[model samples]
Target: MTITIERTRTAPQPTRQQPAADPKPATGSFQTVQPDLEVTAPLGERYDEILTPEALAFLARLHDRFAHTRHELLAVRLQTRVDAANGRDPKFLPETEWIRNDTTWRVAGAGPGLEDRRVEITGPTDRKMAINALNSGAKVWLADHEDATSPTWANVVEGQLSLFDFLRGNLEYTSPEGKEYRVTASETPTIVFRPRGWHLVEKHLKFHDRAGRAMHASGSLVDFGLYFFHNAKALIEGGRGPYFYLPKLESHREAKLWNDIFTFAEEELGIPHGTIRATVLIETIQAAFQMDEILYELRDHCAGLNAGRWDYIFSIVKTFRSRGRRWVMPDRKQITMTVPFMRAYTELLVQTCHKRGAHAIGGMSAFIPNRRDPEVTERALAAVSADKRREAGDGFDGTWVAHPDLIPTARAEFDAVLGERPNQVDRLRDDVQVTAAQLLDIPSGSGEVTEAGVYDNVSICIRYIESWLRGTGAAAIDNLMEDAATAEISRSQVWQWLHDNTVTAEGTRIDQTSIVRIMAAAVADLPRFEGDRFDDAISVFRSVALEPEFPTFLTVGAYARFL
Candidate 1:
């Protein structure tokens, strides 16, 4: 099957507007004073009165290591090379510049045609089930590795290696009819893989080559990209394609790093650079902040970014846990592409990418249930339809479906959404002429920073907690936390800072004085949650100390005395 790229006139175009002059970087002497207000400790004398000495010491060690991890050495090297090659300053394009000057960028807009794109996952016994799903007109088939797969490390290694075997027609399996079935090399539904997370699960996938040398050298970054590279030949030869859904990306740097790796793989393996497509999950709060950068970094190789709902929610809560009551729990339903900020973010993403002539695909409709419940399926289909309607209205080219059962429903909904003619009359509306700059510049409480022009204090506090949890460094800034809603921005900043400062798993030169100040302030002002009673203070302190900037002397001393 030949994949055709269609150019639609209904594609979004930039509205007419006067472009503003480029913004000059802020200068002049600004007051550098930290906020000086003081409050009594909510926990009173009991605040520092919680954990055992050993726990406190462990926390200190953990914090020290996290604050000093070398997370971005390779990324820095690659970036330096790219910058030197381009012979340009490496300063990132400002968000405002991207919004105002980039007129060619189009937001994801409704298209007239919708190619039915549904994905189904098949297992060892369910090859026929998968083929049936594909025959039913599903556009994509994602072979599982993370969730739907139950393969152990050995099996995973074997399965991956056997992929080439099957694709090459060297391997055959017996069908239910007692006949041998062989895979014919032919283009079919787009095949993609959802691999295991890098942190915990990737270790299990290992394969040795014919020379008794490991195909993936242990602890090599090449291990991550090589698996795909080695199989590229088989994939293309077998009539499938090369594509992947990358998970657990922490920031744009990660995306860019992957892009560089992919570039290397393509060049080394003699495959076309754009042939292999990648869809990164903007799951973590940090990933969201760097969405534009990430997209831009991987623009040529990227299919699109997916809004991972559950992981994203978990990221938000984890990032802002220190903000206590001030942090609002995001309503999952309301917080999707429909929510104001999210809508703006998604719209901005669409606009930025489309302006550059890239696809702005929507994320998953995770509400779809199993095939066993027709009522649930009906409701899910309705929800999918509503979501597609919204996405169509907003101009998204495509969306994702989590379950195989929902593939048909999702494809149908998208098809229905695409069938409608672009309302030329609607295009003539005043709102249609409003530039993205104006839309983004619509003043709201969400943009407020402190006098320091940093994020709000609560937001900073939340970021501190999150960074600490992740074993990263912390700094207090009043304005950084105002819009705690976009946890990605806050978390990414912390990660960037950690990366820049050479934070490692080993200890760093932490500012003990700054730590004391932050601890005293947090202990004084922040309210204790339930279970943060006197008895829990030691435990909490120990946990918090494990953060990058835990008040080492004070925490250690307190724990020793308490124990």
Candidate 2:
């Protein structure tokens, strides 16, 4: 069952970014200031409210001040990958060991409305979802603009508008059928926004520094700046600050970068320092080894750490893909949280966070409830409950749920462990000891690449990629909340299987041709309703999964080429 495909790979090249000798950027808010910043995308309805001249200028300032550091960190990420390929694997920084051992230093701990995060509902910030999430009886609402929502220009601006309305008590939605949605919860979940990662660029916005240079803006700064500038003061006045969830960070240096941005933003906005609290997602393997240092770097403005499971798996695959069979993973389904390596990662996260008086949040369980089928919903809830229970028993203070209905089940598990306490941050798992080798121990997991797993990977890659292309980043496929992180795992698994020449449990050789056939069948199974972009999705899956060289992220190349 070998496919007649080119099995050769061109080695990955080093990606280095050097600062321009002079950078020019400005956004004229009035007649006095020249409009040095340009908007490349068309203005959508209500965009003016979010993209006011003053906000644009503030965003421009942030870009100019921090863009170079973002680029340097990104380059370091690539070099780290290249170094791993050459046998220099990621390890704890010797220079930062002092920070790791300094037991007296502690993070700012939890901010207002963030003390108890037992059940956090994660979704996009569209008017409807925002209301529903607010009404949902969860402790926090992760108003996600990152992987959960596609970064279409309209979405970016409108998302800000939604958040603005939410903060001002002005959010109201009426469906075409005249049904109304409102934030009815007496105590709505606290909002913690998740911006796009540093690797991404907001191409629609162009910045010209005072030094007269033009370049695309960093998506991180753009999202953070607009939201922080417009909402920070309001949030502070409302007794909540501009809290955030920092994603895809690879090193402690990147944590320092975020800490600097937080300082600058607070000073610029006239808000007090340490007002902005951030929860860093320990998704990358490199970051797992530097948890203590990451918390130390942002101690003044840090909340806690989250175990982003899917992206963590994808990161492992991306960082160690060129290392051959020892690094190859089996079916994505087989990499459960209880697996030894995953156990090590999560246990270590809980241990590190509790040791520093920070919350240890658990990862997302893709098993979402099904509304149409009572039987399916029952099974899904059971699965989600079990996963949440494990996290709670293992010392996690909170967990993530994609759908609102699953909130109770997750809450119950946490309540069972948490009792009347606000959180279990005091439960420091001192007994948990994890080594780098344990964290990197992929072979210990029990699983294999079955033929069914290969086809499942192909089908998910095609379906999820199509959903993303159609401007819905979070898609419910096969009864799970599929997002960019899960899609990365799906596609990268195929690439990994092909790269390692893995054989299914039934002894079939997995290859590109077989995957192509499986993808076609998957597409055939999906109803090609009007406006659906199946063809485009297939092409994206092919490009990302079948390429000779592995893409660091599935979204980066796709976003750069299209949208």
lDDT for every model? 0.42, 0.85
> After aligning candidate 1 to the native by TM-score, how far in Å is the CA of 40 from where it should be?
56
lDDT of 2 by residue, 1-563 (tens): 11111111222221111122222222443111222346777777777788776677677667767888888989998888889989887887889889888889889999998999999989888888889999999899999989898888777888889999989989989998999999898999999999999998898888765444568888899999899989999988998889999999998999999999999889887789999999999999999999999999999999999999989999998888878888888888989998899999999999999999999999997666767898998987888889999999999999999988889899999999999998999887989988888998998898888888888888887788778777788888888989999989988889888877888899877777777777777777877789888887787888888989788888887888767
Q: Report clash pairs, candidate 2.
A: 24-208, 24-209, 24-212, 24-213, 25-208, 25-209, 25-210
lDDT of 1 by residue, 35-69 (tens): 11111113222112222222222222221222122
Q: Enumerate clash totals for all models, in the order shown.
A: 35, 7
Per-residue lDDT value at 286 in model 2: 96
**Count of backbone collisions within predicted model 1:** 35
Tell me model 2's lDDT, rounded to 2 decimals.
Answer: 0.85
Q: Least lDDT summed over 10 consecutive residues: which range in candidate 1?
A: 32-41
lDDT of 2 at 422: 89
